[model samples]
Target chain A: MYRYDEFDRKFLAERVAQYRDQVRRRLAGQLSEDEFRSLRLMNGLYLQLHAYMLRISIPYGTLSSAQLRGLAEVARRWDKGYGHFTTRQNIQFNWIKLEETPDILAHLAAVQLHGIQTSGNSFRNITTDPFAGVAGDEIEDPRPYCEIVRQWAALHPEFSFLPRKFKIAINAADADRAAVKIHDLGLYLRRSDRGEIGFAVTVGGGLGRTPILAQTVRDFVPRRELLAYISACLRVYNQYGRRDNLFKSRIKILVQALGIEKMRQEVEDEYAAMGDEREALALPDEAVAAMQAQFAPPAYADAAGDDAELAQAAASEPDFARWIERNTRPHKQAGHASVVISLKPVGRPTGDCSASQMRTVADLADELSFGEVRVTHDQNLVLPHVRKSALYDLWLRLGAGDLATPNIGLASDIIACPGLDYCGLATARSIPVAQALAVHLAGREAAIGPLQIKISGCINACGHHHVGHIGILGLEKNGAESYQITVGGSDGEQAALGGIIGPAVAAHEITATVDRLIDAYLRLRRDGEQFPDTYRRVGLAPFKEALYVAR
Target chain B: MDDPTFKLVTGNRLRDGAVVYFASAGIWTPRIDDARLVEEKDGAALLAEAQAGPPPHPAVGPALIDAVRDGDRVVPATLREKIRASGPTVAYRAA
Candidate 1:
C-alpha cells in the first residue's frame, strides 16, 4: 500500500477543514441549499431519497488492515453499523447526518483515505484488477499506474468541472477482471515489440443510459508519454463534450457525435500542439520506478507447491472443498491463492458489510494473507495473498463472520444497486427483487453455475444490469413497478450489452420470469457452457418464449 | 393522472438524516401516522411552509409526496416512496 507523504497528509487535512467550514455555513443558513449542493457533491455527499449518502473512495479498491479497521470504526460510530461497497470499488454510508460528514472525512483522513473525487463532474477513483499483482496471466501489476493516475486526477484544477463525471480504469491481466472496456477511459498495460512498456488506450466506454464499449483510440503510448496522452484525451473531451444537456454530456456521447477516428485525430492534434509542455506532464522514469517499487509483491516463503494439510482438509470436509473451489482463485505465486470473502449472503442486500464483519475481515486479512484487502468490482472483498495451507482456518474464521458463502459466480451471488431503497432516481425496488431471486435460486445455484444476475433500479445502470448475464432493469410503468429483462450481456474480454427478452414483467412475476429463463438455458445449453455462452449460442428466442408462454 | 391532492410533505432531518414527515401542529415527525395529509391545492403551500423555517428539522429538498390515507395511517402512493417511508425492502444489516 502507498503511504501518504507530507504533502498528501496536508492536502487531506486542508480539504477536511474546508469541508467542515462549508457544512457549518450550510447548516447555519448562511449558505442556501442550492449554493451548497455542488460543494457537498464535490466532497462526495448526496441527499438521497430517505437520507444523505456519503461515498468514500477506496482508491483502486486497495486497503490496509488498519484502513479497513478505520472504515469499521466509521461504520460503527457514524453510520447505521454497516456500509455498502459499490461497483466502482467505493463504499457508501447511506444514512449520514449532515453535521457528522466532516467528522467522518476527518476520520477517513486519519486512515489516509478521503471521499474526494468519488462524485461530481470530476475524475473519479481510478480502478484496476483486484488480482493485480498476484494474477498469473498479468503482463504487469497495474496498481502503480492506477496510483499515478489517481495522484494526477485528484482535483486537477483545469479538468475539475468536466461536462460529466469521468472514469478511468486500467487492466494489465489477460483476463479483464477490472471491466476496463466499460469506462470513460480504459488503459491496457502492454509491452511493445521492442520490449518497452506502454499502454493501449481506449476512450468513451460507459454503461449509464447509453451503454457503449470503449473504442481503441491509441494503439500504444510509451510509459513516458502516458500522462501527456491522457491529458490530451481529457482536453478533447473538456472542450467538445456537451455541457447544455446532462443526458448527452458524457464523453461517450461526444465520441458518438464525432467518430472515434475524428476524436483520435483531435486528441492527437492537441497532443502535438502542447509541444515541449507535454513532456513536462509525462512522468519521468524515476517517478515510475518509485511508484512500482511501492507496489512490489510481498515476500513469499519457499514452501512446497502442494500443501498436504490443505489436501487433507479438503478431502475430509466437503463444505471446505466447495468453498475452496468457489471462493478462491489461482495466484501467480506458488502455494498462494486469492480468497474472495463474499458479501452476498442469501436474503441480504448485496454488497453490504456490517461494522463487525468489516473488523473480522480486516483481522482475517492480517492473519491469513498480507495485511491488505482488495475490493472487487462485483462488490466482494479479496484476500489476494492467502496461503493454500491456511485455507481451512481462514474459511472457518470467515464462516463464523458470515463471509464464507460458497456462492461466488453462482445464481445467488447477485449484484444489485440501492434502488428505491436509497436512490431518489430509482423508479422501483431493486434490493427486494435481488433478495427474492437469490432466495428463489439458493438451492439450484450449483446446478445453474456461474450466472451473473445484476439488477439496476433504473436506466442509470448503477448495478451494471446492462452487462449482466441475466440483466434486470426496474422501471415504472403506469403506476406499478415493472422489471425489464435482458440476456446475453457480459462485462469481460468480449463485452456486450444485453438485449431485452420480452415485455416488462410486473414486480411479482420477475422471479418466476427469471426461473423460466434459467430453465430454458438449462435445456438448451451444451456440455460445460455458462449461462452467457448458452444464451449467446441459442439467442433470445428460446428464453423469451419460455418466459412469456402461458403456463 | 397522478393524484396531487392526497399528498404528504416529506424531507430528511438535518441533524440525523432520518426520514421525516411534516405533521399536524407544524411539527416534523418520523412516524408516518403523525403526518398531516393535505389537499392538492394546499400541498405546495404546506411544503413551502415546512421548508421555510428550519435549519434543523426538514433540511434540504423538502417536497410534497403523492400519498394516500390507508385507514388512519398515511402511506406513500409510489413504491419508491413506500420503500423510503419504511426502511430498506431487504435485510440491510447482517445477522
Candidate 2:
C-alpha cells in the first residue's frame, strides 16, 4: 500500500483537468475525431466496438478497499455495471461514454487512481507477481520497485512516444509468476556475493504479432543503479528502434535486427557516457529506505490455534477443503495465507466483475485481508493476507458473489481477451470460445491436473496465448471463425513459446481438439508430470499424431 | 460470383459510441431493420453522407458494409457486421 505524496496528487488533478477540457472541446466540434483520438488515448480512453473503453492503471495490481469501491461506483453510475480486469493487471470499463469520461476519471482520481499510462505508446502499468510480498518463496517485496518505476516512467517525456508501447515486469521470487519472459523488459531480482539485491535484466522479450524471448543484456546491476542502466537501455532503443513500419517498431524487432551483442554494446556506451550523471541517477539510500517503509509488511496477530482451527474447518466441510487446496496459497507469515478469488466460473467471461461483486469483494477485503486486494496477471483477484483459521468464512463469503470457483491454475481457469465481443481490433470472438472451453472442461479439470489455457482473438496476443501450456488462438480465416492450437508454451522461469499443432481447427471442433490433446497427455505422462513437463520430455510428435492423424 | 444485394452504412455514435445504422430521413437508428439499404451504385454516396454529417458529427468511423434483403428486412452479410449491428453474441452484465 504505497502512499501518494502531494506532488503525485497535484499532478493527477492537473491531468484530469486537462482531459476534461479535451473532451469538452471535442464534443463542442472544436477538435476533429482524428485529432481527439490520440488525446483521449493518452488518458486511457479508447472507442471500442460498442462504446468507449476506459483502462485505469492499477500500478502493480495493488488495490485498496476504497479504490475498489470507487471503481464499482463509476461502473454503476456511468457505464455498464461491470469492469473487466485485464491480463496486465489493469481494469477496464467497457461501456464508457466519451461525454462522461472526464467525470469518470475525476471519480477515479478522488480514490488516488487514474487511467494514466494504461494506453498510448507509453510505459503501461509496471506489473509484478500478485503474491510478491507474502509468498514464502519471495526474495523481497517487488511492489516498492514497481512504484519507483511507475513514478519515473509515467509521463516520461523521452520514452513516452516510442517505437511501440512498452511493458516491464519484475519477479523477485523462485517462481516467475509475473510472466517476466513475455515482456518488453524483464527483471529478475538477484543477490550479489555480499547479500545486496540487484537486477538480472533481460531485453526484447514479447508475445504479439512476432513472439520473441528476451536475451539477457546484463547479468547484474546493483539496485542503486537500476534507473541509470534502464535509462541507457531505453535511450539506445529510442535511438535505433524502427518507426517507419508500424508492425516492426517494437524494441524486440530492433534487438533482432541489430543483434543482442550490438544492442548491448550501444547500451553500455550510453551508460559509460552518463558518468557522474549515473551517480546522480542513482536512487539515494534514504529514498530507497523511505519507499521500502511505505510497503512495510502488515502486522499479524499471534495465533494460538491457526492450523488446528483450519483442520477442523476442513474436516467439517469437504467443499471448503477443496477450495483451500485449489485457491489458497502459503504466506510468508505463519498462520496466514493468500487467497485467490476466481473470476472464471464456468460459462462466464474471463476477468469480468459485476458492480455488486466488486462491492462484495471490497467488503470482504476490509474484513479479511487488511483492506488490500491484488489483481493477478492471469485475471484473478488476490486477498494477499488472510488467517488460515478464517479460510472457511472467506470461502463462504466469496460464494455469495459467485467468486468461489475452486479453479486457479486448472484448465477451466482460462485467460481470454475481450476479443470481438467488445474489442475493435479483434478478428474473431475469443470470449465465447473461452467460455465454451470452460464449460466443456467443467468437472474434469481437477482430474486432468494443472494446465494453462490462454486464448487470443488476434495476433496482438492480449490474452497471452503464446505462453499457455495449451494455447488457443482464434482467427477469422476466409470469413469463418478458425482456431489454432499450440502446445508446450509456458511463462515460468523456464519459459518457452508454444508450437502450433497442425492447421487451424475449425470453430466447431476446438474443444473436441482440446479434449483429444488433454487425453493424449494424460495417457502418456509419467507419474506426477504436468502438461508442459510431459510435452518437454516427449516433444510434439505424440500430440500431433493424436490431433491430426486419421483414425 | 453471387454477391450481396445492397450496402448499409454504419458507424458508432460519436457521443455514446453506440452502434448505429444510417436510416431514412437522414437519421441514425440502433436497429438494423430501420437501416437504409442502398444499392451498390448508391453506396458511396450514402457512406459519404454518413461520414460527413453536420458539425459535431453524430458518427465516427462510418463505412459501407454489404447486406442482403431477407424478405422485407435487411441483414448484414458478414459475421463481423452482423455482430456489430447487434451486441455481443454471449450473455453479459448489462446495465
Candidate 3:
C-alpha cells in the first residue's frame, strides 16, 4: 500500500484535468468522434454495444479499506451496484454514461486510482503472485518491484503507444502463481549463487488469436540492471517492431520472427548502447522502504501457540480444520498464519464482488488483519500477513461473510471473464457458462479433487481458458451460444496449451459434457492422479469420446 | 446479409479511423446529416497512408472507407456504417 507522495499526487491531478478536457471536447463536438475514440481508449473508456464501459486500474490488485469503500460508493452511486474484477486484476464498470466518465475518473483519482493504461496499446497493469509476502517459499516480496515498474511505465513517452497491448508479470515465489509464462514479459525473481536477487526474463507470451508461451530472453538480469534490461527490450521492439500488419505487431511476433537468440542479441546490443545511466531510473529507496514498512508483519507473541492445543482444536472443528489445512499456510513469523480469502463460492460469478461484500472485506482487513489486501493474478484476495492467534477468529468472521471456503488450487475454484453480460466483444455468455459448470462440478465435489477450470468468453483468452486443466471457451455459432472444451492445458512450473476436446456443444450441454469428461478422467486415471496428470497420461481421445457421447 | 451501405465518417485513412457499426443498442450513432467526400488533401493523404496497409481492417471491425468507388461518392457499405456511428452527411437516400 504505497501512499501517493506530492509528486505522485500532482501527476494524477494533471492527468485528471487532461482527461476532463478530452471528454469536454468530445461532447462539445470540437473533436471528431473517430479522433476522440483513441483518446477515450487511452483513458480506459470504450463505447460498447450498450453503453460506455470504463475500466479502472486496481494496481496489482492491492487496495486499502478506504479504496475498497470508494469502489463500493462508485458502484452504489454511479454504476450498477457491482463491479467485474478482470483477468488483469482491474475492475470494469460496464454501464457508464458517456458524460459521467470524467466525474468517475475524478472520484477514482481522489482515491489515488485511475484507469490510465487500463486499455489502449499501452503497458497494462502489472500483476504478481497474490501470496507474495506470505508464501512460505518466496525469496522476497515482489510488490516493490511491481510498483517501480508501474511508475516507470505509467507515462513513458517513448513507449506509450506500443504495437499491441503488453502485459508484464513478476513472481518471487517457487510456485508461479502469477502465470508468468503467459505474459508479454515475465520476470522470475530468484537469488543467484552469490545470494543476490536477479530476474529470469521471458518474452512473447499472450493468448489471443495467436497463443504463445514466451521464449526466455535472458537467463538472468541482475537486480540493479532490471530496469535497463526492460527499457532496452521495449526499445528494440518499438524501433524494429512491425506496424504494417496489426496481427504481427506484437513484440512476441517480432521475437518469433527473429528467433530467440537473435532477439536476445538485439536486445543486449540496444541495452549496451543506452549505457548505464543511473539517474534515468532513480527509484527512491525510501519510497520502497515505506511500502515494505506498510507490508511488514504485525508484532506477534513468539510462541508456536501450544501445538497440542492447536491439534486438539483442529480435531474438533472438522470444517475449520479443513479450511486451515487448505486455505491457511505457514508464515515466516511464529503464531501467525497467512490467510487467503477465497473468491470461489459454491455457485457465484468468478471474480465478482458486490458492493457490500467488498466493504465487508475492507472492514475485516482493517479490524482483524493488516490494513492491506492483495489481488492475485488468479482473481482472489490475500491477507498475507495475519497473526495465527487471530486465525480462528478470522475464519469465524470470514465464514459468516461466505469468504471462508476450503478450496484453494482445487476444482471448485474457477477463473472466468465477463462475457456477453458486460463485454461488448464477447460473442457468447461466459459467466453463466462458468456458473453452470461450477454448479454441476459442485455435485462431485470430493471426487473432482484438485483441478483448475478456467473459462473465457472468446479466443482472446482473457480468462485463460487455454491453460486450464479443463478449459471452456464460450463462443457463438449461428447466434447460438456454444462452448468449446480443451483438455491437458496447464500453467504451472511447466506450462502447456490445452487440446480441443471435440465439436462445440450448446451452452446448456456444456456442464454435462464437462461432467462426462471428468468421469472419463476418473475412469482412466491411475490411483491418486490429479486431473492434469490424468489428462497428460491418456491424452484427449477418451475425454473427447466421453464428451460427445449421444444421449 | 443485404448489400451493406457504407459512407466516409472520419479520419484521412480507413486504417487510422476508429470505424464502428450499428451494433444492437446503437452504440455508434450518426454524427452528420450525410456523407462528406474526402477532401483532396485528406484523400491524397489517405491513399498515401492506405499504401501502408490494405482496406477492411481487423481487430475492432470492418473498414468503412473500403466501399468508396467514385473517387468522391461514398459507396453504400461505408455510408450505412457512417450514418450509424456519426450520422448522414447528405440528403440523398438509398434508391
Candidate 4:
C-alpha cells in the first residue's frame, strides 16, 4: 500500500541499472563466480537445485494489487506456473534462466519492486508485522518507521558488508508477530512515560549455525533518535564482530561472548558518543507525515451484515467457520476482515506458490478486497484490509483459484526452507520432511492444536526451526539425511531458542519420530496447555525420555 | 563432496558448457566457465556466473543478485521479472 514516490522510484531504477551492468560484465568474463555470488545475493538471486531461484522482497509483507499482479506476471512469464512465498514475506521463483534476469529486473522496475538486500552477509530485508496498521493492540503503525529504516539501510555505506548477514524486525503491537526478539536487531515501538514514541531496542538475536535470542540492549530509545541509535549499534557490531571465522561471525556470537549487560553498556556508550548526531537523524515531521500518508487505511464502510453473514456461514459450513476462526482476524476498518491465505495444504511444499497461483492471488487482491496483500513471515498471505461482509465472496473466489486453505496456524501449516530440494547447503530435504509431518498430522488436525513446526534445511536456520514449538533441523550423517528435533522453541513475545530433544532421527523416520514426540507432548501437557507451555512447564528432559522410550 | 556433471544457467535456465552471465538486451550468451569448476579456490567464477545475469531496470525496485548452484542446477536469487518477461520454460535455449 506504500506507493513509491519519485525518490524511491528513482533509487530502485538506478539500482536495477547498476545491477544490469554488473550482470553484463560478469557474463563477459570480467567478474568471476565467487565475485558475482555476493553481488547476486545482495540482489536476492540464489542458485538452487533444478533451477535458479529468485527471491523478490515484499517489504514488511505489504504489496498492492498492481505489485501483486506484477509478481504474478513475472511468475507466469519467467518461472514455473507459481512462486513460493517465503517465511520472510518474500516470493521465490523456483525456476529462472540466467540470461533473462536483467529483463526480469527491468520488468520489476516498471512496477517499483527490486530485489536489493534480499541476501548476502549484509543488512538484509527489513521485516515487520503483517498487521502493522490494522492490529488493535498496536501503539502506532510501524510501517512508516519500517519504510524509513528501509531507506536508511538500503546500501548504507557503513554496515553494508558485515561479518555476517544481519536481520532487523520491527513490531508496533503488544503482540509480537515480526519475531522481533530473534533478529540481529529488533525494534518495538512503545510510548514512553513522557508520552513520546520511543523504541525498545534489542540486539544480538539470530538463528543460523548458532542460534541466540537477542538481549534487550535498551528498554527505551527515543523515537526521534531511532536511526542514530541503530547506526550506533551497527557500528559497535561492525567493529568488534568477528570477520575471520564464518562460524562465529554473527553479532549474536559477540553478544554471547560479552554478557547482555556489557553489550547493553557498549551500545549505550556508543549512543552517548553519537550525541548530537541523533538529533540530525530525527525524521522531519513532514517526511514522517508524507510516509504516514502513503499508508492511509482505505475508507471502510460499516459492517452492515457482517455478523449475520458470519453467523450464517458458521452454521451452514463448519469447515468455513473453522477456516474463518483460523485465517480471519479483525481489521482496523469497520465491517472488514484481514484474511490470511495459507500456502500450506495437507502435503504441498511450504511457501511454494505456482506462477498461476501468484497471478490468481494478485487478481483476487485487486477484485475482492482492497488491491493490497501482505505476506507473513510464517509463509502465508494477508489481504490486509478486506471488508468483513465480503469474506464469503472472497473465500469463494480464492477457493476457486486454489489459494483458499483453512489452515493458518494449525499443525498442518508449516514453515520450511528450500532444503535438499534446491539449496546446496542443505543436508536433508526440508520440504519433504514438512510434507511427511503434515501427512502424519493430517487426520488429527483437532488433536494437533496450534503448533508451529518449522523445518530448516540446515543450520543457517532459514526455516527458523530454532523458534518453532516443534523445530526440526535436517542434517547429514553418514551421507544420509538425518533430522534433529528441538523442543520449546518460541518466536513470540517470550522468544527462546529450542533445545535439542535427543539423538537425531533418520530422515525416513522423521514423521514417525515427530508423531511420537507429539504424542509425548499430548500425554505430558496439562489441561489446555499449548506445546510451548507444556515444554516450558516440564522442560526437555521429559520429552527426551519419552522419545527414547525404546532405548 | 561436490556433485559432478554440472552446467551453469543464467537464473535457473540451464546452459550448455560453462556460460555464467546474461548480456544486455536480456540475452544470455555463452561464456567460458570459470576454472573454479575444476578448482574450488577461485569462488569468483561461480559467483560471477550467478551474478552475471541481466540487472533490473531503474523502474523496478533495487536489484539484489544471489545464486545457488545445486549440482547441475543454477538458480538466481533475483529472478521474478525474468520469469515474468518470458513464459515458464525450465530448460535454457541453445546459444
> Among these predicted structures, which one has the highest lDDT?
2
- Local distance difference test scores for all models: 0.89, 0.89, 0.73, 0.76
TM for every model, in the order presented, reads 0.97, 0.98, 0.82, 0.85
For candidate 4, the TM-score is 0.85
Residue-level lDDT of model 1, residues A66-92, one tens digit each, is 999999988899888999999999999
DockQ (model 2, Cα) = 0.68
Q: Can you list each candidate's DockQ?
A: 0.58, 0.68, 0.03, 0.06
Model 2, TM vs. native: 0.98
lDDT of 2 by residue, B1-95 (tens): 56558988888898899999988545889888889888899989888777765667788888889898877777888777878878888787643
Clashing pairs in 2: none
Q: What is the lDDT of residue B17 in candidate 2?
A: 93
Residue-pair clash count for candidate 2: 0
Of 1 and 2, the candidate ahead on lDDT is: 2
RMSD of each: 1.9, 1.3, 9.0, 7.5
Q: What is the alpha-carbon lDDT of model 3 when measured against the actual structure?
A: 0.73
lDDT of model 1 at residue A481?
88
Best-matching candidate per DockQ: 2
Greater-DockQ candidate between 3 and 4: 4
Number of clashes found in candidate 3: 23
lDDT of 2 by residue, A353-460 (tens): 988888999999998889999999999999999999888888988997899999999999999999988888888889999998999998799899899999998889
User: Candidate 2: misplaced stretches above 4 Å?
Assistant: B1-3, B24-26
Among these predicted structures, which one has the highest TM-score? 2
Candidate 4: segments with Cα more than 4 A from true spot:
B1-95
